[model samples]
Target: MFHVFCLGFLCCSMVFGILLPVYESYKAVKTKDVRQYLRWMMYWIVFGLFMCAETFTDIFLGFWFPFYYEIKVAAVFWLLSPTTKGSSFLYRKFVHPAFEKREPEIDEMISQTKERGYNTIVNFGSRSVAYATQVILQTAVKCLKT
Candidate 1:
């Protein structure tokens, strides 16, 4: 019984994860349609995040509760169905708003970091090399004394 369920799950995952995406990618390439490609890309990214959240939810809440499986089924259906607009809802309500609010702050931080990051990395690398060389020379000196 468990094996049957596992097999079915594997099949479904393979179809959805590999076959469908490959088909869509081929279509996107053949048609040279940027919108179609972007739409699918956005859908997958949203769905991937949704799946991650769902996994954590299942781990924390699923074992103690009944009807979790049913809820997951419904949730998957909602996410996959274009009419439900689950991906769009998630992006507009959560992803877009959060990024929009932080965009200026994020851009400023990136610019500031870019200015300092090269010098920081060079300083750190040179310090690390100097320390390593000092340790090696000290070890060699100790070996000579012994």
Candidate 2:
């Protein structure tokens, strides 16, 4: 039971960390919000962290057995579904959703970019392989040259 849950959790983490970011980048390009992809990726990281914490605690508390841990999974999933890193996990899930308050989704970001103009930007994906690999290769080559 735990194994299955763990598998699902692992998949979610991979999607949020990797697949989702790539998708966000595509979304940003399509929406003409060059920086919004990075922002969305940041939100994914925040959500992944929250899911890890909540699920970890529930598993730690020994509350994830017999009933298949639906409550814990649902609680964590719903909490992390929002697109914001502003609120803490618990508040964002158990509280924020109640008020129908949404974190900035990629669509909202694209809209903002359309309405206004791009001024401030964040590289949210500087650590991405495509971005980081060039520097890594350069450093390796420099060391070889030395």
Candidate 3:
């Protein structure tokens, strides 16, 4: 059973990591279509977030539920199928609504952070590093003296 699971895992890794990218790249290059690329990106982003949520759900429900894997497989099918619009429904019902409410505040924070400028960030980072180095040196010296 363990060997079979390992083999299936390896096969999935190869298909997703290697074959899928190659196929997507070929399609992108052959079509030379920006919309296709954007659609692909959108699908992957939605799928990634869905996977995260699914993982947490699995962690919580898996031990007690014998049919968890079947449910997850069905969910993957629902999410990937355009006819179902699962991804769009999730985005519209959850993500978009949340972000819409916070958009103004997020934009304000971004502008404020940008206004601080590059030099300010550089100086802050340098100061932090110097402080850390000083602390480490003092600790070493104290250890040696002891």
Cα lDDT listed for each candidate: 0.72, 0.58, 0.67
The order by descending lDDT is: 1, 3, 2
What's the ranking of the predictions by TM-score, best on top?
A: 1, 3, 2
Candidate that would win on TM-score = 1
Off by over 4 Å in 3: 1-22, 105-146
**Best of the two (2, 3) by lDDT:** 3
Cα RMSDs, all models:
4.3, 14.0, 6.1
- Candidate 1 has which clashing residue pairs, if any? none
Which 10 residues in a row give candidate 1 its minimum summed lDDT?
1-10
Q: Which candidate is the best by lDDT?
A: 1
lDDT of 3: 0.67
Model 1: per-residue lDDT, tens digit, 1-146?
Answer: 54454355446555664467568768987898997676566567677886788778857866665666556556555655568867567777887788789999999999999979988999999999999999999999999999
Q: Tally clashes: model 1.
A: 0
Error of 1 at 91 (Å): 2.8
